[model samples]
Target: MHILVDRITEKTGLDPEKVEPAVGIMLNFIAKNSTREEVETLLEAFPAAEGFLAIDEATENKGLFGGLASKMNASVGVLAALNEMTTLGLTVEDIQKVAKETVEYTREKAGPEFTDEIVARVPGLAEIT
Candidate 1:
């Protein structure tokens, strides 16, 4: 909480004392299931000390965080795809060789969403495995 307040205060030119309690309460709330006092404290719009930490802790437990997870996976996939092409010298012409085999595999294992998601994330890799 202190670290966050210091950083935020330094950046925003606000007093660290003003935000520390709020951030601490927010963090506590995030760590717990939460209560009314915390909610009331947060409604005041004071960016609390533990806001980022609490969010990190809360989100750490949720596996199906759909948007954030998808975005993170998409970023990784895109980087990998680019790396495969650039570092491995996978050419535009090689795309043809990969296309047919991928379609066959997709047809064989149709239910898994991972295949479709990876394809979408990696752009031209849709027709590759």
Candidate 2:
């Protein structure tokens, strides 16, 4: 849902003053959260985002600020895993195997892209001795 918002914001190229109202209207529909069930029902009727929001305490607490932050963190984790797997010369199956393992292991010092790119540069990286 936030991803869709970013795309819309970019495409419309509207300033915050204009964009915020549109955003409020959209998120309001997605959450459909109100003190009264009838209001929530009316809100859900808008048809803007009935099934998209998978909200919970953490996501709800961020109040629209945390979703993007969470996406960035997820991106970092994925890139880090890619870096480790590539440099280790993990084959497709190896990568598939290590993906679960990578979740158990994360590098705090370096991005995986750095390691993967370096491995690609080494002449013998793809071949084993």
Identify the leading candidate in terms of lDDT: 1
Question: What is candidate 2's lDDT per residue for 1-129, written digit by digit as tens?
Answer: 444334444554433333333333223321332234433543344333333232222123233333342355433323333333344344444433322222111111123553344334323322221
Instruction: Provide TM-scores for the models.
Output: 0.26, 0.21
Error of 2 at 40 (Å): 3.4
RMSD of each: 20.4, 20.2
lDDT of 1 by residue, 2-78 (tens): 44445545554544443443333223322232245543443343334235446434433232232342345444433
Candidate 1, run of 10 with poorest lDDT: 25-34
What is the lDDT of every predicted structure here? Answer: 0.38, 0.33
